[model samples]
Target: MAQVPLVVGLGVRNSIVSALLGKGSEKFNYLHRFLGRSIFVASTLHVAPYLHKYAIDDDFVAQLGKPVISTGCFGYIALILISLSSIPVIRRKAFQFFQISHWIGMVILLVSLSVHVPICLPFTLSSLSLYFLDLLLRLLFKTQNAFLGTPAVLLPLSDGLTTLLEIPSLTTGWRAGQHVYVRVFHPGMGLGKMWESHPFTIASAGAEGEGDGEPLRVFVKSVKRGWTERLFGFASDGEVGTGEDRMRFGGAKGGRRCRVLVEGPYGGTGNILFSSFSSVLLVSGGSGITFSLAQALSLQSKALLGLVRARSIDLVWIFQSEASLQAFMPYLLPLLNNASSNKTASSFKALKINLHIYITRPSSQFAYDPSLSTTLLPAHDHLYIHTGRPNLSDLVNAKVEEAAMEAKRLNGRGVNPCGLGIGACGPQGLVRSLRNVVGGLKGERMGEVGGVEVVTEAFGV
Candidate 1:
């Protein structure tokens, strides 16, 4: 009970525990709330008996004056505050306040408990030690210093709402679906941004060859305010002036460059062997495309080397408008173009790849241009783009049916059925819908497909 917070809080330093539990640190965040509630309940149970006994004897004042009783009372107050601040509504609406109060409340509770009961010192010490160790590990290994930070190029996508960051220097290998914390250093970003580190999923796959270097890429969407808005402003500042100056400052030759510290390669699909799946479906919404994009690219790279068993791969991406789809054309084009063009190995050519893009909103800035996509993308049979929201249930059912058919084919050939793998990363609503869709699948449908494994990626504090 005492160590629950330790497990819930530790991220990188608790990799062993995460691995043992078959989940990444971020994946188990729901448990943080649960553990917090359990702690508060247990604490109440322990303290209620003492309060009742003191009140019954009419010695409440005397007991309350004691060091242990007073400390315990203070700790309980802190616990109550912590629990209250952690409520979903409060936490979401006032995250900064919630975060600060949580930290302060934890310190008060832990210190009070240590003083209230000497026997609890070991638990308190252990928790503090592990918490600091994770911080130390993040500082020493995960984070690159601002002074030594690598230069990154920022390119605003066609949407005018998202920015693409590319860092060629930091070639550290990371698994697909993993994310990193980035702290930018730039003159225009202000002091507030200098100390802030935000998490973004790695958009590109890892290095394919031993000596080959792959640039780290991530897509950041700017909201109305905060760090991301400033970043977008800085990136687009060069284009503020009219005429030839804009051409000289903003295009491919003069994209904004900023030095940034990258800390991570954390929080990925844990214990899920992607290559083992015979059929794969990757889904993403808006900027969440980064996770699915990386997974698809990595699996394709692995398949080329005969390391993966997947025969077919499908990607379904839902975007707010055509602008977002156009923005991702550069990345999506290669995946579609290279499917059958790899000359080095014939086996790689045999991998069936399909891409589906759904644009839910009409283009707001300009009319949808069909030529931009058609000219860039080849006339591939498996590529599709739709105008409305996708039927998630139908899409999922189609994949399940494909997997079931593949399983029968494999069994007929006396080969083992490798099952289906579904990876989804998006808004909470989308994730919930997908989960319900998958969960609602009949048992026979599940069994016929060998087995369906679903892995989801999401981020929040």
Candidate 2:
């Protein structure tokens, strides 16, 4: 009963929890899971003594038959199911089942819990009230305007392994690193596909100069054999076999048009301002570049307008294969060119930008554009492309040292430097590794760099 409101608060988007704690669901979902486990353990402890007493008194069967006891037993069963199904491996493999079962289990648990213990009614009612209020407000404001659907274009890329979604009409603008939910309408794909909404990070930094009126972009990688696979197929002319088959039919250039509901602009660097830092580092792995790319562009835009305290911005992107580079060239080329131009701009104190690309696997069919290699390669001082995985710890330390040196130089000229901000958005492994590296930074190292702040947006539930 005591944990009721806290559980609901942690689960809901617009709740007192978010208001007081200032963290969105994306940031604190792990805490919700922890509290849920606590509820399960408490429920178990409460039930054990009741069962022991009933058995000792020899009224076990009779007591279990009562309405209160039966309902409590059912609620415990529901809680067990919810807990077991929520295991990461099971949840990822059977997401729909997990999602459906969770909601159903919650309903059963809440109803039975109230009936089993009348004293818990007030607490349960309060939880329900908070949940519904969150739902009502989310529907009325945040996700309401997008229900009717907007025209979207889906273009397959990266040897048909990824689909680029372009929603040109969604020009309302969004914060850097934020994501939105997209529900596409495909008549032939069945009702499940139509009703389901998937979250994808916005790749374009929409409120800025060049980004104004630019379509909201999302790079959907075919990582699983589920909704994303189906979406990739829909975008790639419904090719059934191998990736080569899809590409053989000129699917890369073929663009599919459909309407989709856009439900967010949620989950970003909430109160942390990128412009407030003296140096910024953005890191991403695979498709997670969408978040980092948007952040980099937004920071650059702010710097150009002299609205930022940042003087240096570094972007580190890791790709599994060289072929993946082709899909991002459209965005990468322009960014490199802009960074190169910024270096020569004498009149403005422009942000020094550096782009580091690390390709972990180099296949024989390496599809890098020859023109880009010739033009943007060694000539561009800001772009560095390397083979093999990066030594993240070493790289971070290098940046810290560089920032510290620059701070000392600036201090001699009577200027104090702000802190270094590190933002990472990627797979669990990458984010975890980065976090460990940042955590290891101790007293002198941290202070020499003014200070260091870390923000992360990790993939997965």
Candidate 3:
């Protein structure tokens, strides 16, 4: 009973289900938690009958000395400790302790189970095999060998910063919007010394840069907490943003470097959703633009090659300051430039690519920057910059109108256009608000074709 649920949950981890769900696998997280909770109940009942039958006699102590009996008792202790430590409150407060204890407890329990009922040894071995196989594969295949654990050059900005690693040798191409799990090692310790890894959207795509580029760029807002705070001390992409010793890094002063191991090209609308839709609206907040950029570029690539059905891509990004918008320009420029040069987006003659930039907090100097506008692309209009937070309800309503028009153009009799894939990756609050908007919009316009489907990746701080 215990192993059954665990196996079903852990088995084929990189199976078809994970491939389809991607980072959206959180939907199944509850199932794992529920199954885990049942282990305690099942073990308690199974042991009750044994205790009732044998307790309160000289023979009880003697009987427990047998290998099977003793092993079962020890395994029960292991299960109890693991269950207690796994509670949400305790786990959250002391994750490292919980993690260490969980693994140790699991090992003890599995070893005991193998001996308690020798016939079950195969099951224990199978469980351990799956766990180690997953770990080994993650280490061996997740990282690109050429860029496998390389030191990155960091640039801190007044707002956010970007990291540049030597992915110059990486050959595997990644779609935009997909992210990599990054593990940074201390300088001189080498990238192989990976202990902590965090997921970051690959801000730069493989195909859009000035030349063949590696998955070397990730724009990050250096908020003061955990990994983000430690990053500033290790390096910077521009002028160092924070920390007491904010020194300039350059060739003259041996460029500051932080080693990192890159893993994955995981999860994006382009991989599963965008290719099927004719019109897509990407709503983003702050660095969430990274998620949208990849899908847009990917959809464009496919459309140019007659691979996808998407013809219209609209990006609405919200940032705190104009500097952030400036900092993120590198990601946008290459993608747009690449599209302009690639057959002029000829798939849909009515194809209209919209880039809307909203700055929530403008600096005092914002009043002085002349010519805030820069030429973006040959076919489409340049960036449309707006002030303050966007009216998201209105934004979705407008998208709905576009969808209606698209349906009409398709020669349908009031048939809904293919539903729009509206994706976002940003702050949790932004996702919630967008979710509300999408939900209400969908409900209000039930019969509308080309429904608004939201795919959200909460870019946690």
- What lDDT tens digits, residue by residue, belong to model 2 across residues 369-450? 4246463243467777778899999989988988888788778888887878998988999999999999999878788768
Using all chains and alpha carbons, the TM-scores for the candidates as numbered come to 0.87, 0.90, 0.76
Per-residue lDDT of 334 in model 2:
63
Residue 342 miss distance in model 2 (angstroms): 7.1
Residue 175 lDDT in model 3?
Answer: 63
Clashing pairs in 2: none
Lowest summed lDDT window (length 10), candidate 3: 246-255
Stretches of candidate 1 off by over 4 Å are 1-15, 47-66, 145-147, 185-187, 208-213, 238-255, 344-347, 364-378
Candidate 3, 244-357: lDDT as tens digits: 333321111122554567777665553456767656889889878877876666666556656565566788989887777555665576555665566654553333467887
Candidate 2: misplaced stretches above 4 Å?
19-22, 56-59, 208-213, 238-251, 340-349, 365-379
Give the Cα lDDT of each candidate: 0.77, 0.78, 0.64
Show where candidate 3 strays beyond 4 Å.
4-16, 19-27, 44-101, 146-153, 157-166, 187-193, 207-216, 220-225, 237-259, 268-271, 335-352, 361-382, 412-416, 442-447
Task: Write model 1 residue lDDT over 1-461, tens digit each, in one string.
Answer: 47544543643334556658656576766666667787888988998998889889999888888999999999999999998998989987676578778879888988897898888888888777777777887888777663588777776655777877888786656888888888877667877676677889998887856435358899888867767777777777644324463332223322477788888877778778778888899999888899888888777777777777887699999988776766677787777766777646555544557999888886655443444545545566778877789999999999998898899899999987878899989887888789889999998888887788899875455
Best by lDDT: 2
